[model samples]
Target: MKFTNGYWMNRPEYDVESPMETYDARQDEKKLIAFAPFKRVLTRGDQLNLGATTMTFTSPVENVIGVKLEHFDSENHGPSFKVNNLDPDVAIQIDDNTASLTSGQLKVSLPLRTDFDLKFTVDGKLITESAQKAQGVIFNHDTKVSYMREQLSMGIDEKIYGLGERFGNFVKNGQSIDIWNQDCGTGSEQAYKNIPFYISSNGYGVFVDEPQRVSFEVGSENVDRVQFSTEGQSLQYYVIYGPTPKEVLHRYTQLTGAINLPPAWSFGLWLSTSFTTDYSESTVLKFIDGMKEHHIPLDVFHFDCFWQKGFEWCTLAWDKEMFPDPVGLLEKIHNRGVKVCVWLNPYIAQKSSLFVEAKEKGYLIKRQNGDVWQWDLWQAGNGFVDFTNPDAVAWYQSKLKELLNMGVDCFKTDFGERIPVDDVKFFDGSNPKQEHNYYTLQYNKAVYEAIKDVKGSEEAVVFARSATVGSQSYPVHWGGDCLSNYNSMRDSLRGGLSFLLSGFGFWSHDIGGFEDGADRPTPDLYKRWTQFGLLSSHSRYHGSNVYRVPWNFDEEAVANTKRFVDLKLSLMPYLYTQAAHSAHYGNPLMRPMFLEFSEDPNVFDNSTQYMFGSQLLVAPIFNESGRGHYYLPGGKWTSLLDGKVYSVPLAGQWVDEEYDELSLPVLVRENTILIRNEKADHASYDYTKDVDIHLYQLSDGKVTTKVVDLHGDDVATVTAKRKASKISVNTTGISGSVNVYVHSDNNITSARLVDGVAEIDL
Candidate 1:
């Protein structure tokens, strides 16, 4: 994707053309287009023979301006375009020399007199602008096509993040990224999910509005500017501006769609039958029973592949030799208060009994030469399902309906990343190259819709692998194919943070690792990863060749998982509210340090730690030392393990703390009230009655409030106001006495409980 060699030279065979001067401008009621030449034009005759270059300026949704530079507009063989949800009678303002368009608070202003004076703003304040020579049309003669490229200003020390589940680095300043989805594991430049949106430290984000591949050079091609380009006739992108990074996400999710809140049980621990391990009903029973005997709470039991016989993936029949009585076994498992998940892919093997029917019904993708596309990668003679066709989608979903009828709760939608691109024809006549990465979206959507139709909308969830821009609507996705080491574990956390910022509500990963034979991790690694996994938005234990039961490693690992799982389930009263907030707004559950502490410069590059929600900070131990070093902003933090309060000064510095296998540094932020469920043996237990509201250190002039779900409504709101010597507590819709803990002030005179409210006097 790089085209430049130095300051003045292009690559050997690539030709780069940039707009140098303006020629003419035209205005209308809804849009403005400007024509510009690649070189300086002295007269009207100079615009005559400007061969093979085009510069255009227009708007898609008002307030968003698109400037495209094209080298060859004659390649008119693109697919039929369709962009929905546009306002045609939008408000627009244009003058003789300049024009401004507004959509909500976002505006794009273009100076007709200048060549590249394109400014983007929010609420009448400038977010960014492209100056002279910052816009260009690039042509690579070797490929006989062109791209639209744009350059924007970047601050000297601004950090960039969120290019979609990236694992290279937390800050994406110096990486060359492509928006093509790949099946590479957690330790590579390739990513399973690639989004063309990036947030900058200056509180703005840009989303390249294309489903096709878009390449980005984040200060790599040019040290001072961030450049992005796509190969097409017209390049369109949206510059979403907010004064804060959180607000930027809010705006971006408004443009795209937000995620739905997954059911409560999906947040609990899921124990899976490892991918290539051979197991029968007896072995599965032993694993589940062992987890219960060791007190490791499990919510969902998943059966990976091999549930169906080999080479007949979509047959939808349970292997009789393995299960013998599939429906009876599922009912027994459900009777134990556990849900069930099964593995499925979109590929239909040639040997499957339904393959001939699919081919005869024209439900498979065909090549231009009139042959069915088949491959031997994961399964022999595997032919993929053509999801672009509605009949084909129903054909695939009908197979899953049978499984749902047999008591399957959810599915592990896997392996849409390996879709074939070249020499294939889709049923909807979409370009195969464009459908390569987007197939996962349609594939997951079909299964998710089926589940929603069968299991009720409140109980639908899928643990998907690959994703596109709007795939966050599917509830839960996991980090795929990692090694069994601490390094992989840390990178997985980083990837989850990136994914969360990409608008995904729930994310999980393999507890130990997925790829290698390091199945039995050292006791230290197992315990540390367990703590980290339990703190994630979703927790699971999955691997490739070996089992992931807690007792398989050590007693400490089992105990550590129990402790954190219990902690997370107890915190459901708080976590569910966070989930509701993320669903209603655009904020995420697992947040990067910079997202919450944008004013603290020390948190800009710290990816080793993150805040689980708004109230607790979790720093996973990545090394075998079992000692963790992290920083806390100026506040009084209390350890959740032991109620010990520590004061941090104004300046931030790394503090060393050691945690055993059963603990990590869970610190309650200052001036916050947290609600916990007293009983957490099951994830779906009642969370209102017997709930404990733990209030942390409250400073002067700080008012804390707690809202618990009262009969499916947030009817009860507890307010605590403190002024100087007395803390007055007021409550509504409650009938029990509230227990209050004063944080080590030593100036308390007396405390009284009055009508379900506690007032402490100092």
Candidate 2:
């Protein structure tokens, strides 16, 4: 992906052709087209010998400009991300000298009589530009293949964020990232989810419109620009204008797809049967019983890969030897008010009874020779299902439907990253290189649709592993395959925050890590990770070769997990509202500090802590020493756990807070009202009953917060307006009694509300 040996010259066996000057320009009703020669046309003879690159610019929606640079005119490949809701009407003005296309406040200008340049602006102020050899048609001398690349200018001190769930550093500057989906685990630079999108600190976003492997060099190849390239005859990208990072994500997800609100029960604790661990029905029962005995609030229970017999993964049948009556066992779990999620992948082993049926029906991916592709990596003689084929997708979905008929609530769709590309063929005749990354999108979609068909649309959810661009439409994805250590815990947070910037709303990771290096996670690590995991949008306790039952570690671990689980259940009224916001807009449940505090430079690289929802700041304790350093942007932060007040400075100051294993640093922002369900034992409850609305430093202003029900409908709206020492409270569509508490100077002023309105004097 890197083309330059230095700034002076291209690497060996590389030939680059850059646009030099615009020769001609034209405009249609909706778009402007310009032709630019690779070099300056010195004579008429030069025009006859060289071909010109065509550049087309249009507006898909207000404030977004789509640019396509092409070397050869060809029909577009199919399976683009769905953007059916975009506006098509845009205004353009053209003359002999220049062409200007305007979309709302954002405008793109191209000079016709001068050098080849495209400048973007908002309200006549320049944001970014592609000029002076910034757009190039590159060729590899050894392979005789060409690529289209674009380099957009980056301003001084402009930083980059989001490349999809990368476990590296949070800021993407100086990073060479590839949008290739892989199963390289969480320890390396390789990512399971690689989205071809990035938002810059200067308040503009660039999204490469390619399903294939797009390569990006963020301020690496050229320190002054962010260069991205895709191997093809044309490159298509969109420039989205947002003066703020949050608005950027909102528009980005609007162009791609927004996250769906998951079911409310999913917010509670999920206990999984660890991969490669021995878990029969009795073992599952024992774990469930232990959780009840320890008073840990449990919701969903997941059965991992070993649920199917060995070498027969994705058979959709429980191993009878282990689970004698799978339906009965699931019914027992369901009888105890727990949901069941079974693990599945797209791969079908030869030993599976359905493999022959899939091969005969052409439900599997085939090689160029018209034979089913077979490999022996995870399963013996396995073949991947081709979701591109409608029948193949239906066949796979039918198998999952049977499980749902037998009381399965959801599925953990795993291992879509290990797809075959060499000598492979899709039923739709898609480009294999592009399908390598896009396969997960189709794979997860098929399963998600099947669940929606069986369960209602409001109840559909999947715990997916691998993803590419636009896969944020899936409800929840986890940090894949991490070690049970403090470093892995830290890196997982980094990856989740990075993913949040990429538009994924709900994310989770293994509570005590998926796999420990040589042994299981220590009791200290489990206790610490428990606090972090329970705070995630989706919480799950899982591991490999070891049980993740809280009591397995120690009694203290059990108590610690129970405490956090209860706390999370108590906060469901607030958390679920945040989840609904993520589904409606694109704000993530877990947000990097920079997204909220973009003006503070200290938060640009701070990945150790994040904003949980819009009100609370959570700094997870990563080390065993129980010491965490975090920065609080200028505000009056009140500790959510203890009523400790800390006034953060305007310049942003770091605080090193020490705590015992029972708690970490969680602070509530000032001038905010947090709604909590004080009487809920489970996540799915009447959010308006006995609801406690805690007013935190409610400065003289009107603050309104709504509580959404399980179906993402507004059940209640609490409006608080402060005038001097008196605060007026009003509620609409709310039932049951409400308690209003005012937190100031470690004193609580309580008021009981019976009807529509009340007033409290502070």
Candidate 3:
């Protein structure tokens, strides 16, 4: 996608034409359009042959600007992204030489009569801009049509992040990233989910609103610019402005879509049959029985690919060889208070009976020559289901409807990536190149809609493996296959964080890694990963050839797994409420440190550390020694392991005490009101009764309030305020023991606190 040999020379076959000056500006209602000529027009004769690009600038919603630059305006690509039309909230003022528009806190000013430049200023200071040869149209003779692209300016020290579940480096500064979804595992540069959005450290973000393939060069092709191009004549992108990182996400989610909150039990521990591992009703029963015997909490059980026979993937039939009695097995598994998730893929193998039916009915993707498209990549004669066809979607869902009728609670929708790219045609006549990456969105949408129909809106879920721009609307997604090692574990975390920044609410990874064969993850790695995994939005045990049962590693792995699962169950009141918040608002369940502590510079690029909810901080051990160094933002953090307090002031660092395989680092920030369920036995326990709100390091003069779900009706709000000599407690829908822990510069002589009420004296 890189078209430049250097600054002065273009690639051999591509011709680049950049806008030189603004010829005329037009305004209609609230929309502003700037006509820019590719060549300099100083005279009337210069305007005669104005065969140049036209850049149209408008505001879709407040604080979000959409820029569409078109070389040829005749192409009409249907099935655009679902952008809701909201009334614009910006005021526009245009004059002869200068034009300025304001939306929320974002102001865009253009020097109309001068050089064509775009200045995006938030809070009256320029964060970045599109200057010089930034906006353009490129023509490649090797392709059928010309393309348009936009290159926005970047700061010298700015670090780019996001672009959807990237497994590459955490910072995407000098990388050539294509927003094309592929079924690559966690160890490769290819990503399962490739969103055309990136946020920089300089406080602004650009989201290419196309569901199709959008290529981005983040300071790679051009060191000082972030260039993005599409394969067609028109390129449309949105610049979302945020005064802070959280606000940026707020704006971005408002534009794309917000995620629905997954079910409460879905947040707990999920056990899976390792990929390609032989398992039947007896094997699954033994694993469940063994976990119960070891006191490990397991909420959901998943069946990987081998659940169906090898050549009949989309048959949705239980392999008679392995699971002959799927109905009875499902009933038995559900009888043990566990949910069931079966794996599924979009590809229908030629051997599958459904494939022949689909081919006869024209329900499969076709080539340019109007033949069914087939590939031999993961499976022989694999034909992709054409999600663009409504009848095809219904046919695919009918297959799933049969499984759902047999008590399959959820689905791990895998491999929507690796879609056919060349000479292929969608039923709706969507551009094949555009459909290459956007197909996953349609695939997930169909599956999600089917589950929503069967399980009701709030109960449906998918452990999806691939995604695109608006795929966050689906509930749960997991990190793709990864090797079972410490480095892979770190990369998994980085990938999840990247996805989180891209507006995904829930995500998980295979617990001790996926592809470890001979040199498997040690018991140390299992225990360490168990702690981190259990703290995730969803926890699952999956591997390629090996079993991920805790006992397979060691006794310590079993014990540690039990400990963390129990801890998560104990903290259900906190985690469930956070999950609800994620569903209602688009904030992620697991957040990077910078999302919570945006004002602190130390939290940037701190992938080794993350916030479990709003209060708990977890820093997993990257090495086998279990020694982890992390930054705690200026507070007195109390260890959740032993209740030991450590002071961190003046933006410095802290090292956790030697955390062996049995334990990892967990800290609660100061002034946090930790909410937990009173009972930790059941995943679906009533969170309202006898809940404990443990107050940590209560700083004087600040009001601390926390919210927790009271039954399914109302959320209990608890507020506590501490003054010089007394602390006042108030509650809205809660009646429980509020344990107020006094810490740091407090002179309380006597503490006589009672359940549901408290009074402290100095």
Task: Output the number of the lDDT-best candidate.
Answer: 2
TM-score of decoy 3: 0.96
In candidate 3 the C-alpha lDDT for residue 178 amounts to: 84
Residue 116 local lDDT, model 2: 82
What C-alpha lDDT, on a 0 to 100 scale, does residue 639 get in candidate 3? 81
Across residues 1-762, which tens digit of lDDT does each residue of candidate 3 receive? 698898878888887788887767777777777777877788789888667767667787788887777777776665677775576777777888877777777777777656778888877788788886787688887874577788888887788889998888888889988888877888788899898888878777888977777889999998999998887778888888876666677777878887777777787789988887788888999999899999887899999998988988877888888887889999999999899999999998988878889999999999989899998888889999999999999988988988988999989999988877788888999877777777887888888888889988777789998888778888689999888898999999999999998878889999999997686877888888888898888889888888889998888888899888989888887788777775566678899888888778777778878998788998888788878777788878888877778787767575756777777778888877676764576666667566665666777865555455533234676676778766666666665444544443332133323655566554
Candidate 2 residue lDDT tens string, 30-122:
888888988877788878767668989888767888898999887665566665347756778888888888887889998875778889999
Clashing pairs in 1: none
* CA displacement after TM-score superposition, residue 380 of candidate 2 (Å): 0.6
Please provide TM-scores, in order, for all candidate models, with all chains considered together.
0.93, 0.98, 0.96
Clashes of each: 0, 0, 1
Scored by CA lDDT, what does every candidate get? 0.77, 0.88, 0.81
